[model samples]
Target: MKIKTGRRVASALGGAALALGITLGTAGTANAWTADWETVDDGHGVGIYNGPSSTSGKHGFHDLYTPDEVYLICWIRGEDIANQGNVWYRTSEVYYYRIGSYNLWGNYYVYGAYVDNYYAFHHRLDECKS
Candidate 1:
């Protein structure tokens, strides 16, 4: 009977350890960036803008290299490009760029045309409050 009790205790401890590990693992992932990273399909690179419109001289602060993955925070309806719709995704992560002698990094907006066509579907992205 003593040997059986010892085995039961060990089994219980192992189960507890497993549960703790799972909890910790999930917690670790939760701390990571919550947005999905998508690749920019444009081979020539795409411009990262302050606003959704490319025609806006105030926007397009930096250029995001093509085939790079960007963390999209949300979406908004703005100027249409290449007849690809007016959808745009706002990025949450900073990108590095050089302007003349200075290097700069900032978060910016990307047109949906640079991303997959699937993103054009309605409700595919969380709309930005702005």
Candidate 2:
């Protein structure tokens, strides 16, 4: 009886150690936010905005050409374009035609209608606050 009780106690401690090891191994190694890539509308490069709306003014401002990919950060509701949904995506970076890729400093917006996956990310992306 004594031997069986000791075995159970050792097994429980081993399980706890394994769980803690896993938790510590992954700590601080994951990104705080999720990101994905979406291609720009073919032949129609779009402008990057400072805010969710076009009227928000351009921030770190630049244009993204068709075939160019935008690294999406998140989305928010904004002014409508071409009668399309009033949605816009916040992008982190863009590539210029003649220049190399540039980082938008993380505070820029692109009209959803201008991206190929405009409809696909509506539910997948986390909405921007305010």
- Which candidate wins on TM-score? 2
How does model 1 fare in lDDT?
0.52
- lDDT per residue for candidate 1 within 4-97, as digits (tens), equals 4543454344335434543211211111222455665655556667677887543345565543445555677899887878887766442232
lDDT of candidate 1 at residue 55, scale 0 to 100: 72
Cα lDDT listed for each candidate: 0.52, 0.58
Candidate 2 structure lDDT: 0.58
The alpha-carbon root-mean-square deviation between model 2 and the true structure, to one decimal in Å, is: 16.2
Candidate 1 positional error at 51, Å: 0.2
Tens-digit lDDT string for candidate 2 (6-114): 4345434433443343222221111223445566777566878876687888754457766555656567778987787887886655544334443343446788888
